[model samples]
Target: MAWRYRVGLVVAAVALLGAGAAQAYDVAPHRAVYRMALAKAASGSGIATAEGAMALEWGESCEGWTVEQRYRLKLGYTQGGESDVAVSFATYEAKDGSSYRFFIERARPGSMPENISGKAVRGPAGVRAEFEAPEPVKLDLPKDVLFPTQHSLAILGAAEAGQKFLSGMVFDGNEVEEATEITAVIGKQIPAPTEGEELLRRPSWPVRLAFFGPDNAPGGLPDYEMGIRLYDNGIVTEMKLDYGDFVVDATLDKLEKLPKPGC
Candidate 1:
C-alpha cells in the first residue's frame, strides 16, 4: 500500500514544461475526503465486509509540496472477527524533486504502532536515503528513478499526449527499501459528468496503474493495481484498488480548495 499513498499530490497549478500541449495543466491544492467500501471479494478470501474513510490534505509551501493522509479501515472476517486498521502518513517533497521527507505510522489491534521516517536526496550521482526510525540504515538508488510527484507529472503528460502506455520506477519514502516499478495504461479522454460538483466537471481519463515489486519479471502479475478517473486538472474523482483477493472502491465525498502559497 505504500505505492498507493505515494500517488497523492499537492501544490498549486505548476506548469508542466515540455508537456507539449497548449492547454494549461495545473494540479490543484485541496483536501479530499473519500468513503471506502468493499467492492468485491473472492470466495474463501475470509473478508466479510469492509468499510472506511480516508482524508487527504494536500498543500503547497515555498520550497515544496506537502501532504497529510489519514486512513481508517474496519474489516469484518467471516470467521467471526474484526480488525480496525489506521494509518497516518505525511510527506514533504521538494519542488524540484531533489529531496523528500516522509513519516508513516500504522496501527492495528494487539500490535504496536509501526513507524517509518526517512529522507532522501537525489543528485547527479543518484539517490541517497537515510532512515532515522525503526532502525538506522542508508540506501542508494539509480539515477533514472523518478520521485512521486515527478511520476504524477509524467502520467499527466503522457495522457495529454494521447500516449496509452507509460512505465517507470518511482521512489516514494514509503518503501524505504527500493523503488517500485509502475506501468500505467491511459484510456481515452472522457467528458466530465454533469452530476458532480463544479470542481469535478472537467475532462478526465480512465487511468489504470499497475505496481510491481522489485523481483517481479516483465509481464508478471502486479503486486497491486489501481484504477482511477483522473482529471486533466490532476484531481481523482474515483479509485478502485485491486488486491487480488478483494477490491476496495473509493469515491470522492468532499473536496475543499486549499489556499496557495504566495511564492
Candidate 2:
C-alpha cells in the first residue's frame, strides 16, 4: 500500500468506534471539558527524523448553542529520507441518534493528487460507507480500515458508558500488533494557561496508558512498548511509540470548537 493511504487508515482506525463497549474512567465530569495539545518527535544519532502534533477539544455548547458534538484531527509528518512532507485532516459530527457524518482530506506539497472525501452511515444493522471521488476513479481500503478497532475504542472512551471491551484483546495489523488491557494508573490535573482574561480556562486531567505490541507490525518492526497520555475528558494528548532505533511522538495543540456550516 502507499504511504498516504497507510496514514489515512491509521487515523481512521484510531478515531472511529467499533461495536463493543469501552473501559470506564475513574474521574469526574467537571474535568472533562478541557483541551489537550501534544508534540511528538522521532530521532536517532542526535538527529530528528520525524515530528508531528495533534490537538483535541471537548466541551459542551455555550448559551444558545446549536451544535451538540464535534471532533477533528490534523496530522503532518516528515520521513527521514523523504524530501516531501504529508498533511491530512479529518472531522466528524453527530447530527442525531440515527445519523453522523465525517470528512477527510489529504494532500502532498507539490503534486495535484486526487483528494479523498467520504461519509459513513450507521443504522440498526451496522455501519456502511458512501463515498465521492474528485474524478472518475476507484479506491480500496485495508481490511482493518473497514473493521477498525481503534476508532471503536475512541468512541467507547468518549461515551464513557462502556467498559467491557477494554479487557484482554489483541489488535493485529499486517505490520503492527497491539494488545489492550485495563490497568489502574495515577492521573494529574494540569492547569490551562490564560491568554487574555476573557477566555475560560478549563482544568485538564492526564492519565497514562501502557500496553505491549510490535514495533511496526504492518510497516516497520516487532516487540515494542507504547505509552500514551490521555486526558480524563477522553482526548489523547500525547503518544510515544518505541522500537529501539525508531521512535515516534505525537502532541495535540490549537483546539477550538469547529464552526457549524450554515444551511
Candidate 3:
C-alpha cells in the first residue's frame, strides 16, 4: 500500500464534520479511544491479519484548536512479512482558518522514523507553507481549502441542515500539506440515543467522505473512504476506514471529556 494511504490513518479522525444551518456546532474538548482490527481483505491485498489501537484528542485554546492523533497497528501480510506501523500527528489550527501548524511522524519496525513539521498561513494572496523536516521547502496551498477541524465543522453544519452532499478541498498534513478533493455525504440526523450514563448530549448524523488527491488520476478511485457517526458537538461515536485493499473497523472503546483551555 502507498505510504500516504497508510499514514492517512493518522489524520483519519479529522475527516468527518458538519457544515450546515440546521444547528449550531460547538467544538467539544474530548479524548476518544478506539479499538481497531481488520474486518476483511481484498483478493490481492496481501494482508492476512491486523490489530491496532488509536487515540484522538481534541482541545481548544485562545491561540487556536489543538489536536493529537496517534496509531499503532500490527499487520501480517500474505507475502510472508510482518510489520508494526506507528504514526503520530499533531496540529494547531486557527479558528478563522488563517494559520495552521503541524507535525507528523511515521515509523515501522526496524526502519528509521520519517517526519514532517511545518506551518502554513492563509493570506489574501493565497496559502503558503514552510517545512522544517525531510528537508526544507516551501509549498503553495490551494487558495480555497479547509484544514481538518474546519472541514469537519463544515460537514456537521451541513448535515444539520439536511444537505446530502458537499464538495470541497482539505489539507490534513498528508503527503505535502496540499489540499485534497473531498466529497462528503451527510445522512439523516437524529437525536443521540440515551445510554445508562448519557455520555453524549447532542444530535448526530451519519457521514461518509471520499478523499481524492492529485496522485489519483482522473477516472480513478479515491485514495481512501471513511464512514462515521458524527455528533453535533463534533465528536465521533463510530467509524470505519475503507482502504480499497482492505477495510478496518474502529469501535469506540472509551471516551472522556476534557476542560476547554482558557487563555
Per-residue lDDT of 49-68 in model 3, one digit per residue for the tens?
A: 98898899988786567889
In model 2, which regions exceed 4 Å deviation? 1-48, 55-81, 95-97, 134-226, 241-245, 252-263
TM-score versus the correct structure, for each prediction: 0.89, 0.44, 0.90
Worst 10 residues of 2 by lDDT: 60-69
Across residues 23-100, which tens digit of lDDT does each residue of candidate 1 receive? 234677778998999999889888899899888887767667787888888889899988888888898877776788
Per-residue lDDT tens digits for candidate 2, residues 1-263, read: 01212222221113333322222332111211222222333342332344433323222221111112222323333433433333343434342222223343444557774354454444556444444544332223222232222443443353343332232222322221222222223344456546632222434433333332324344333344334554333444455544344445554443443432332
Clash count list over all predictions: 0, 23, 15
Q: lDDT per prediction?
A: 0.75, 0.33, 0.75
lDDT of 3 at 200: 74
Q: What is the lDDT of residue 52 in candidate 2?
A: 39
lDDT score of residue 229 within candidate 3: 84
